[model samples]
Target: MTPCGDTEGDENCIAAIEALFKAYGSLRYGEEVTQLEHALQCGFLAQESGAAPALILAAVLHDIGHMLHPDAAAAVAADQNDAHERLGAQALSKWFGRSVSEPVRLHVQAKRWLCLRHQDYWEQLSPQSKRTLELQGGAMTAPEADEFERLPYSREALQLRRWDDLAKRADHPTPSLSHYLGLARGLLQS
Candidate 1:
């Protein structure tokens, strides 16, 4: 059964999501943009690219694990890998299906995969990303890349990663968090 199968569960899920953003959305993990801004920008990019609702949702919530981390700023400051991808996906799985959660689970893998698959991808990474890449296992090995490619939602994860790489611009305008939550509510209904 879905996590938010009941009306009360859905309300609780929505409230939890709202509370999450409200509580930690201002935190940044070595990025110029705040967590909320990065999320909104990524969601906006997905919308602009005409991604499906699930993908758009995935984009918006992919980095939520960062906010969820107990001390993400400290983790980043220490150059540690928080494994936010897995954490975010696990949290989201309660309210969303694989289409939304799996991409989040594998977005970091997608970054590693892209570094191996595309020569220029590594060069495109910001210094912070490059530092985190080492913490995240750097570029994928051949076997790892193959495994990542075989995973379901791998392509979507790659798309999400690309948007993630571009979402750190400060002062970028985006739709309010409520707008994306509206999408989330609609997704729950359908």
Candidate 2:
């Protein structure tokens, strides 16, 4: 069901992901690092923590919707919500399992959940993240929090969110895109 269909190691899927990065990965959307940098750092953090392959892949691709939708930044600037997490999840579902896609979908909600659960968490958000927080429905209410907690993969989404926050370091070193893509290729092949 991937964009390139279900063929093991589909070249079109791999090429699509590669093309996305080649085009947009170099751009920084009000962040210290480029999109690819953020992705690599996130994947590194997840891998270093010994997360499962699906979780690592989810972390690596959490922001790909931004690449897929070029107008997301302009939309945010115009006070519109593009719901990149939802977009990214939907795109990824074509190529990945629910274990990967669900966390990508819930990562935005995970941000809202963290803000509600940890009082200091709000202070840690980047300026752009702060803006998106409002656009993402602000902090979660008690009922919303309780509801979110019951969702499958919500916990992994929270972990992915944590890595998302930390992955913005300007000078973090990580493996090449092909290295991570090779890891992903294994999953795609399966």
Best by lDDT: 1
As for candidate 1, its clashing pairs are: none
Indicate the TM-score of model 1.
0.93
**TM-score of every model?**
0.93, 0.92
User: What tens-digit string does per-residue lDDT give for candidate 2 at 78-182?
Assistant: 535687888899888888789989999999999999999999999989988898899889999999999999999999999999999999998889988898888
Instruction: Give a tens-digit lDDT track for model 1, residues 1-190.
Output: 2358888888777888888889878877455887799899999999999999999999999988876788876764575688889889988888888999999999999999999999999998999989889988889999999999999999999999999999988899999999999898877632
- Report the lDDT of model 1 for residue 42: 97
Q: Which candidate leads the pack in TM-score?
A: 1
Kindly report which residue stretches of model 2 are placed more than 4 angstroms away from their true locations once superposed: 1-9, 70-80
Q: What's model 1's overall lDDT? A: 0.88
